[model samples]
Target: MLHLRAVCPPEQTDQAIELLRAHAGTAHLIVHRGAAVAPEGDLIEVDLAREAADEVVDSLCALRLDRTGGITLEALDTALSDAADAAEEAAPGEGADAVVWQELLGRTGEESRWNATFQAFLVIACLLAAVGVITDSPVTVVGAMVVGPEFGPLAALAVGAVLRRWDLLRQAAAALAVGFPVAMVFTGAIVLLGDAVGVFDTAAIVGNHEVDFVYQVGEASFVVALLAGAAGMLAMTSAKSAALVGVFISVTTVPAAGYAMVAAVAGSWDRAGYSILQLFVNLVGIVLAAAIVLILRRRKQRSGDLLRPLSRG
Candidate 1:
């Protein structure tokens, strides 16, 4: 659910209220006129269900309240009121299983954009992975995985597949297809240069025992990917973003990519291929898991709405 607090001039209050009313799917109306301490205008509070949040926000944006006059909008977090509880109880099964794919797509698109922050994260993750492989430290490898930002694109791709949004799928695929290879090449070059300078050696790459752990593919890897993907999607949508850090640390894609680069530099083509395969396995598992979850959520939403008609009568 979403709660909004708006301080708008007398002239804009009516329009703002209208916008909220029109877009909010199950809004429990609350009007407190002329009870604001802002000394500028009335304080209008709006409470909306979670499913209706996106539409209500869109309507609010359309009003241009931010630009027009001295209007301020603030989001509030609060428990549902009795009225809201009653409304939910009355509606029962209505919209219970709605997928809200467009909302999820919008979120994916926003997070998966190829931006400077993402590039920096990618570089850092790859660097960490290379360093980890050279040092033969599982801790460092996990750190590198945690630092990687590749999951956003992967999640976006899964969402695209579920929604059948070709544009989103294309953008996500390009990012993943282009981004990982680029990171690998750059890291591989670094490894090569380091090797030439005697800063890294074949023994450090091949003798370092961490390669065995990353190259082996099994049900554990698939399960980890599946759990990470679900947690990632939840983190993206949920207010608790801090949990995503944990999700990032749990995946092996970055570590495997880094290991692959190290193996290539050390002239261990077999190990390099194995590492690459491991990375692919994890990536595919994550995308498939996320897509399935999204599809299920959508189906549940549809079933809920079908059972209960919009009109109470």
Candidate 2:
């Protein structure tokens, strides 16, 4: 279930009430006229079925309430009321499968940005992977993979493609374009300095066959990329934070990028090429997989899955 808090202008209060009352999925509607001081409007609150959220939100948007007032939605982790249950039962789809566009857009919007913290995390994660590659340590590589924040933009890019949002797509592109290269350059410089001090060398980077999978581009790379991509998208859309961690370590994006830098600095052109290819494969595979999932989800939502209640298992 979803809880909605909408502030409606006086002129639109009747329309809002009419719309909510007409919807079978809406329940526990409470109206406080002239209660919203900041927006100077009536405060309307209701509990809605997850499946019905998109339609209701769209209606509100169409009414221009989004511009004139405000609407905020929150997921109900547990709703014990029979009224809530009836509302859910009256709705069209399962809560778990509902595609709450507003929530998704808000989530991806924040994540897709190349903020200072995101950049710092990326650099730090890549540097850790660089160390892992040089030391031939699987643990350090996994640590770097978990720390990398590249998935945010990648997920955003997938969402943008599915929704046809050019702004989001461009922002995601710029983030990856700028963030990765910058991290790689910094990692490469670190490698160069380490090389100058005799602490890093080409042999250590190229001879680690145990972790060669990080740089080796082959059939398995594509498979892992596809799986990771799908899992990543599911995590983002479903609010599965724990599953997200698995997606992080399951793919080679960060490690490959770090390896590319390390190999380039060591003058191992072939190794660098392999690492770069691995990175590209992972990126393409993930985006493609994620885009497919998002499109399918959108389709399902349109098919009234978003309006139907979940069947008790």
lDDT of 2: 0.87
Q: Give candidate 2's error at residue 81 in angstroms.
A: 1.3
Tell me the deviation in Å of residue 76 in model 2: 2.4
Error of 1 at 58 (Å): 9.8
lDDT of each: 0.71, 0.87
Itemize residue pairs with steric clashes in candidate 2.
51-306, 91-307, 92-307, 92-308, 92-309, 93-307, 93-308, 93-309
Pick by TM-score: which candidate is best? 2
Off by over 4 Å in 2: 198-202, 239-241, 305-313
Q: Candidate 2 residues 63-116, lDDT tens each? A: 898989999998888888998888888776576667788888888888989988
How far residue 295's Cα lies from its native spot in candidate 2, in Å, is: 1.3
